[model samples]
Target: MTTELQFFMSESKKKIEAKLPELIDSLLAPESLKKSMIYSLEAGGKRIRPVLLLSVLKGFNQPVEKGLEMACAIEMIHTYSLIHDDLPAMDDDDVRRGKPTNHKVFGEAQAILAGDALLTYSYQLVSTISEEPSKVVSLMTELSRAAGAEGMVGGQVSDMEGENKDLSVEELEQIHHHKTGDLMVVSLVAGAILAGASERDQANLRHFGRELGLLFQIKDDILDIEGDAETIGKPVGSDAGNNKGTYPSILGMDGAKQRLEHHLALALSSLKEVDMDQSLLIELTKYVAYRNH
Candidate 1:
């Protein structure tokens, strides 16, 4: 990665890490439930969604702090999803970010409640944005649509049904688009909206987000095949073991790599459609496309 990109990512991660605990502490919930929520929140990962939001703000010359609340909100929703995904009814995994999954550490019921809390709390955080009430509402609406049944939840349902079945590339793409791509696209859209970006710029950023989401998932599929348990923080071949439809499964390894490149190119091209300082975003796209974990 470029030194500038690395510096930006480090700053983003630091901001997220510093702010998340305070957000959780402000929630007036039972201590156990709060701990459960914080456990997964603190379980470290790349913090990509929040960083993506802040990156868009930075690209537009907006104050990163102005978007920090919404950024943390995105991370909460993401961590919540991970907790629920690890439950017995979903992926049923026992590891995440090199530690036991939420369900494993907090029990199934508490873990479920933790996910619920975080999901709801995210909306609360968004509502706290006072700079622009209308923009806040727009962010909330976009988040609801993106994270709701019409988006991520819908994609998840499609994924569950596609398991053990031979799914075509189109079908797999559909699943990933909704399940994994919606939130990602919305993260960028939320930042653009908060920054008062032009409609044309917002549209371009949304397109870039969509392609970047696909690129992120495709790289994940590749990592699942080629990465180790130690580096990836989860077992390799879990997708194959679960009979989940993925790019590598449907397109073969080389074909998956080609598809990854295709999305990467589309993502970069979409960035060019908007007139902004895209250097950070361009480098972040490369980071996502090539990350090992």
Candidate 2:
């Protein structure tokens, strides 16, 4: 990662950490489910999704506080998905973000329940936020579409089924477009919509988000091949080990790097058109392709 991107990630990490407790308490339950949920959510991550959402909010000239709940809700959903994705029946990962998988720590049953609770509670958290009711409703709809059968979940299904098959580039693109790109698109668009952004700006931001999302996933694939386990906080070759289709698998390392650069350029160009302080987003876009972890 570039020094600038490292600074952005470090600053964003501190912000997420500061709010972690309140976010957990806000979504808390009386049962052990709460404990499990907090355990996994607090396990540590880049908090990239929430930071992205908040960046868009800032870009659109909205008060960052106004998007706080939305940011937290998206993070909750993302964390929940990660927990479930690491289960023995799914990716079967034993460690995540440099710690034991939720199922490994909480047991498979409670881990499942914790993920369920976080997913369900996300909607509740968004609903209670003080945004326009119509906007909130629209945000809820967008999030549902991103996380449901047509998006992340569908991508997961395709990924699982594609493991043993020789997936073409088009097929692999379809999966990443949904699995990784969809929620990212939602993050920018939702922030724009909530900030009362012009329709034209929203379209531009969505384009930026799509390119950014694809770049992010391609970098992840590269990291799987070349990153350190300690730096990436997971098994470095898990993608190959699991027979997962990836950009490098189809494009080769040089080709994948070229594609990442291309996407980053397009993403930066899109953001350049907007009248906003894009320092963080620009750094993040570059970092997505350059990060070691």
Candidate 3:
């Protein structure tokens, strides 16, 4: 990774980690719920979504502080998803971020409520962004669509249904487009929208986000096949164990690696189409492609 990109990522992570706790502390909720929510939020991950959002804002020369609330909102929504995804009814995983799953630590009911609280609290954070009401409304709408039934939830349902089935590549892509790609696209596009970017620029970033999201998932599938449990913070080969359709499963390892390069090129090309200081974004894209964990 470039030194500049490493510095940018570290600065972004510091900002987000500081803001997350402050947001949670402001909530008027039960102590247990608060504890449960904070537990998962504090559990370590790359914080990629929020970092991407902030990086986009910086790319457009916007003040990063202006987008911090939205970035925190994104992280909250992401953490909530992880919490729910680890439940017995879903992937039935017992570990996340190298720790016991949320349900295991907090009990299933509290864990469910914790996810619910985070999801709702994300909107509260969004509502606080000091932008024009129209822009805020637009952001709220984008977030709702991305994280709602037509996006992540819908994709998740499709994923569950496709387990143990020999899903065609197109079908698998359809499932991932909504499940994993939507929020990622919104993360970049939301920053563009907030920066008062031109419609064309916003569209280009959205395209970049879509390609990057696909690339991110493809790398995840690859990691599942070849990543170490210690570095990845979860068991390798979980996808194969569950018989879930993944890039490596459908396209052989070589084919999946080739697809990764394809999406990486597409993502970079899309970023180039937009007229902005995309140095950070470009480096971040490379980091995503090569991230080990």
lDDT for residue 280 in candidate 2, whole number 0-100 = 74
State the lDDT of candidate 1 residue by residue for 112-169, as single tens digits: 9999999999999999888768888899999999998999888888999998999999
- Ordered by TM-score, highest first, the candidates read 3, 1, 2
Write model 2 residue lDDT over 67-107, tens digit each, in one string: 77787788888889999999998878888777889999889
Number of backbone collisions per candidate, in order? 0, 0, 0
**Model 3 pairs in collision:** none
Per-candidate TM-scores read 0.97, 0.93, 0.97
Q: Residue 253's C-alpha lDDT in candidate 3?
A: 97
lDDT of the structure predicted as candidate 1: 0.91
lDDT (Cα atoms) of all candidates against the true structure:
0.91, 0.82, 0.90
- Least accurate 10 contiguous residues by lDDT in model 2: 20-29
Give lDDT tens digits, candidate 3, residues 203-255: 99989988888899999999988999888877789778888989988999999
